[model samples]
Target: MNVAASIADFETLPRLQRARGAGRIAVGQIAGRTRLRTLFQEGCAKIRLPRPTGPAVEAVLINTSGGLTGGDVVEWQAEAQAGSRLSITTQACERIYRSSGGAAELTTRLRVAASAHIDWLPQETILFGQSRLERSLDIELEGDATLTALEAVLIGREAMGEAARDACLSDNWRIRRDGRLIHAEATRLTGADIERDASSLLAGCNAFATLVSIAPDAEARLEKLRPFLATLPHAGASAMGERLVLRFLAPTGIALRRSLQPAIAALSGAGSVPRLWTI
Candidate 1:
């Protein structure tokens, strides 16, 4: 055997990278337009804003750490003042690498005042084989406030011929409106269970996304964006009461994004997504 032709597999001595950050923005009406009043940030999480245009304010969030692995902790928080209209998104998709120890944790907390509108449209989260990640999103909304949030997940990369069959993921969400619980959901998937029911639960797809909107006219937007969903395969769009949820599965990350852009644009009512999304 030629020694030079063989590669080393040393999982025991992997390099460790850790970072923590948080960001907050309080927006209020200035000359009848949304404007940031107070902003605070520390650690790995951040929020960047663009020049004022119209009454809606757009923000871009960043994680300077690039990616995360086991034993890492990151926190994100935001606030939307009453009558403020804010839309936020990540600079890029967040990636989680394989780990051998504790799982990475990402906790986000958001508050929306009465009559405020917030759009939490972070990009996707890609997981690598043997990766363990736990994330939770908690939102508190005042009465009559509107919220539009989207989350996407990619399990491994098909281009690399890799499968996240050994990864573990736990995603949780809790939402409250006017001090009353409105929606609470949790999804847990383990490596073994994923491999066992990949075909059934995942529907033979490698990536999936969900978009939720809560507003007085949330149900009406379903008909407005239904045509876009019709253009994609393995997609579902529905509305109940004051909430609309759009879910889709695709064989590749590109396809899922292609299917989501139009839906997000129409529902967010920004005429387009954040500037960093196209980049």
Candidate 2:
């Protein structure tokens, strides 16, 4: 079957960036100062923004029809100005349906300019067994810009007695500042690997997550969050100059979510957890 995709942008001035693919790849702009929106019946959708500032840009993704069944691909891009600040969020959790043939992929790109900031706080991603998924995030930033991101994955529904015994999952993320790579990570999970060594990969865990922050005060932020980070049964941290990486592994999805809340609040300085993630 041919892959399906779509792209949209919420720009308001010197022309925006937009691209989508559905068995075909297309690239274009939304034009700055123009507010644009599109509805996707099926296939992949992408949103791009350039030199954005002031009011934060928002996107609401709804799977109105139902869960994704076929091979669907989705991508998103957001770019901010030298002193702009932007926040990108999803209206709801992304649901991955059982794949009939190949897996689905979601790619996101974020670019921030000097002294700018971007917050990538999307809802959780639910995966069904027999499904395959690959998600990639690329962030490019200028000096003194800040980027805070979160990634959480649930293998299967415990209450439903559903387990991803034969499923496959892959996730990758990369962050660059001033054209220099600063952070990179990749995770791949399959049925055989999980069964063979559950402890090492899943650690008898059904869900896990990672939070990465890059800023001038990343070290201090890491120190402040040390107490909370220490509470995790399995956690790790590495810092240099203005960047800190944090990872968490839990036996249950609830546990993982519980541990992530305080850490995110402390680091992001948000009054409470993101509303979209309450579910």
Candidate 3:
């Protein structure tokens, strides 16, 4: 075998390239105003701080790689100091493309100090046929800290008449208050789970979302949310102690947002949805 010829042939062969990114941000109160204290970004992960219209500092996350596929990894971290307010949202929907072999992974970690509030309102995540994604969210809160979080998933593009005939998703969430676990949930769904017609499952719906709020007044918002939830086709809200959760299902993303926008506005401590959600 000729050495130069063999080397050239090896370089011609196809190779798989994966995406990786990580970002971190911290905010604190500075002389009665919330301000950014620390910011970090690496790889394709980016953080942008827009001017605040109110007391809360807004941070927008961007994935410069455009989309994710098999073997991709991304991580995010956020911190809010005592008496500070922070709100975070994504620049747009996250797209998950079909994987050739391995599954993509996404992880998020958050910390809220005493008397602080953090709102995590990322946009919907859309998955295509044969796509595989694993996601985990972990949060820690101190005394009287508040958190509002939303996660939505779309099976496929409704406008293109697409369906996630073959896909896989594994999601996990854990929230703790003052070192005590307050909420924990795990969700796993395969193509077969999406095909089931059972009501307890997706029920043939292509879109779904879960919203959660943990605050001192969480239960107080239940009654105010019920009237609005009743107007939507498939929306429900329940409160237990200081935790409130809402679930929504719709045939399309538009219908799902119709209910989600209002519900978020009510539960969000700022009394309005994140500006990015409208834009």
Candidate 4:
């Protein structure tokens, strides 16, 4: 076998891109104020900033590879100690490119202490053509703790006039409070099912978002959030007990963000969205 043929043989084999990341954050007491006590990370993921923002600590997550493709693995874990207030966001959007091999996987786990407050607000996840992604999130909240999490999924690149064909996405979320499961949501979209179920499930929208807020005041704030939902072309808002759920669908990410901007700010109870939000 010649050297050129030998090298060509090696190149013909499947090429795999792999990455593993883990992050940990814990709160502690600092002069009678809650502060981060432990922050650990490994692999391609890093915590860009873990600083104090008003009454809470804000943490920004970063992925150095710029994007995730086939066979990539990513994981993040965060914990807020008792009486702590923590806010988390990503530095930019997570792009999922086409996968010729196995699916890319992502795992996230969150723990909130009693009387603590957490805001898990990351940017969108853009899916490219023929991409495959599987993700799971598990959250544990103490009896009096509060949590707010947001996720946005974009089917394709709008500016490039791309389309998501043969893409697969599976997302599962489990939320528990006081050792009891309160909410569980699972979504699976296979290759053909993407365009097949669009009319009924997604209303032909290529982009969508889900935001959940759980707190003692969640129900009481429903009235304040209703007006925001009424303005969207496609949106739904509901409050049940300690949980407030918001759903959005739009033709593009920009449209969806605009439609959800008012509701997001209202539910977050902040003057603005997360600092990581693009524009």
Could you estimate the TM-score for every candidate? Answer: 0.88, 0.76, 0.95, 0.91
**lDDT tens string, model 1, 1-279?**
655444344434566667667777778777878888878878787778878555678878888888778888888777888889888888899989888798989888889898888889999999999899999999999988988888899989878988787878899988889878887777676876654356656776778888888888877889888777787878887788887888888888888888888878887746576667778
Better of 1 and 3 by lDDT: 3
What RMSD, rounded to one decimal, does every model reach?
6.2, 10.5, 2.2, 3.0
Model 3 lDDT per residue over 1-279, tens place: 799999999999998888999999999999999999999999989999988888998999999999899999999999999999999999999999999999999999999999999999999999998999999999999999999999999988998999886878999999999889999998877888535456877888989999999987777888878778888877788899999999999989988888799988988767798888897
Span of ten consecutive residues with least summed lDDT in model 4:
263-272
Pick by lDDT: 2 or 3, better one: 3
TM-score of 1: 0.88
Scored against the true structure, residue 216 in model 2 reaches a CA lDDT of: 85
lDDT of 4 at 172: 95
Candidate 4 Cα errors over 4 Å, as ranges: 1-15, 193-197, 269-271
Best by lDDT: 3
* Deviating ranges (above 4 Å) for candidate 1: 1-17, 193-200
lDDT of 4 by residue, 172-199 (tens): 9899998899888997778676453566
Candidate 2, 18-107: lDDT as tens digits: 223322111212354223233222344433333333344444444343444446666666666655545555656677777777677777
Q: What is the C-alpha lDDT of each candidate?
A: 0.82, 0.66, 0.91, 0.82
Displacement of residue 95 (Cα, Å) in model 2 is 1.4
Query: What count of clashes does model 3 give?
Result: 0
